[model samples]
Target chain A: MAGHSAGTEIERLIQLLSRLPGLGPRSARRAALQLLGKKETLMRPLADALQDAADHVLTCTTCGNLDTTDPCSICADGRRDKGVICVVEQVADLWALERAGANSGQYHVLGGTLSALDGVGPDDLNISGLVTRVSGSDVREVVLALNATVDGQATAHYITDQLEGSGANVSQVAHGVPVGGELDYLDDGTLAAAMKARRPF
Target chain B: MAGHSAGTEIERLIQLLSRLPGLGPRSARRAALQLLGKKETLMRPLADALQDAADHVLTCTTCGNLDTTDPCSICADGRRDKGVICVVEQVADLWALERAGANSGQYHVLGGTLSALDGVGPDDLNISGLVTRVSGSDVREVVLALNATVDGQATAHYITDQLEGSGANVSQVAHGVPVGGELDYLDDGTLAAAMKARRPF
Candidate 1:
């Protein structure tokens, strides 16, 4: 049906584009048409780029960050604090922390969190790999920078429990009202926590 | 900065995905991550699909519809009303009309409508090709199924002016409250048009 007016090739392209995160059927069709319109400037280059990424991109063997290298540029960089490992639920969270300039330490991507309701558990995550990395490295601290969500916190707790007496200090990121966030917009729990940890500012 | 963690290849891929019609930078990154997660099942196939589309999709020489062939399926189909050419601004429009079963005629895609502010003119569109198609063919009617937008009306007027002496009758699609649309929710213009063109049920 999709190929009735446009070709089968365009239909297939739209199908693939719809599989992408933000695009639906209409947007995918629009995108396909746009690409066809700008084939020389966009469509051919997009195909080449996707092929390049599929062929070259690899997950870091040490931290699980997606990159072009085995260990990744982050893991390969000796300047980072390798003795401190920052644990994150996903590569996006790790990137968020890195973007905020909050941590100069290496990261461990958990891929996902512990969610009992969703049938996810310790074995479902990268917890065993985290333990392996800690047991093999001279890490001074294992920082859990997971999300504030229940699953993220539960995963952090589970990781912390696993690393008990592993000859390294285990810690997690703080919880407080976000910077530039209005107090009225803050939830009761956040307000309570912010009050409990009130600063001199 | 995008290459800081995900590598230059991924950064470049995100850059191209963001160039798509509906995807922004953040969504593009998410899409890239999703593609990477399913490289074998999705990413590789998507790359091949895009390549195939870019390589094979061509505009129909007869109707300007995009297809795998020069004349396109609609133009070549012996069952369709080839004597009645339905003119639309884009292939999407052609498909929309086809989806609604509104027309079973050959199509002419203008690619885009005339917009003086946007620097688009009659010469910039497929007007001359349309003239040639009508002049050299047995076409009896030209249905302007263009959108009711300002530019769409302007373009329709231009095409009508050019086809003045042509034997083929020119007709714009009727305007009214859309089928299954409530009268209260309809725009004033649509209500008036519907009232003026009212018929016994």
Candidate 2:
């Protein structure tokens, strides 16, 4: 309770910061203290920028990526190869693929995977929009870059079935252990997945 | 460049987030992405809290600890033993001591330790204010909870000298390896501190 105060807004800020992944109450307290130390240098600009982003960052109508414009940079660029569209779960994943210097064509953000337990389905996703884009356009291939979770695979299969006989090749990207999340902490399900996808199999 | 965007506001927020201790570009990106994903759930409350903290939280008049009121909670609490004041460089250090449940007295926040290289001196610190508090009150002891840095030791000495003729007993906290900072990464000074303060000398 480093920065905790009765009805103090800094306390609330610390609470919110603590809720973030990888940030505990101690980390949140340190962060809040740092902000207080340099209010002009850090806090003011942060607040203004957050407000600006909240007010202005409208998601791209077609791709669902956060953008100032309606179509996003990838969708608007005429020079980019439009025949192939890469479908990703989140805009951050799309950006990661771009950072890797691969996939220069286009993107379709699925919003999230189809988690039946979470009540997430194809209709709940941006898949219907993706289907529309694939069926109405001269697209040659749809690359599925979804994660390798059971829900992710189910979503991929569902999308593939939707694209069947639509004159567009449907292929799912490989599923494997993440470069981050620790292998030791992985449960039995992921261990089985790793074993099945082992090399030379 | 994980979260960098064309917008000046977006770039500024990402830059500020990245500058936080223990938060590099990767962590900052992950945090920003999380914020974007749950904008309404996280951002609104966070923004309001930040604004309110920035506008209201002020430095304590007595101890330099940040607080909504002038004297801060410790200084304000009448039940707290004011005869023994625990002096610490940062409010974080004060909170750490509080978490350990060792000291039950009041606290005095120094803001930072004396550093000649950084042009910080006793005058720059809350030293004179501390001396004033000691002089005016019936305080019997002032415990130094400063970090075991070179500057920390120097500031402790300086404070000891100031309280020498004031009838207040001054004591420095014991030194040891940090709770988290690895031994391999510790500087020579910290290593010497750990060795010199070894048990059973």
lDDT at A80, model 1: 97
Assess each prediction's global lDDT (C-alpha) against the native.
0.88, 0.80
Query: What lDDT is reached at residue B149 by model 2?
Result: 74
Best by DockQ: 1
Q: Candidate 1: where are CA atoms >4 Å away?
A: A1-3, B1-3
Candidate 1: tens digits of C-alpha lDDT, residues A17-88: 899999999899889889988989998898888899999999888899988999988999999998999999
Give one digit per residue, the lDDT tens place, for model 2 in A88-199: 9987787688778578788899989999799987788998899889996899999999887788889889999999878899877765676797889888887777778889
Cα DockQ of the candidate 2 complex = 0.36
Cα-based lDDT at residue B171, candidate 1: 96
Best-matching candidate per lDDT? 1
Q: List the residue pairs that clash in candidate 1.
A: none
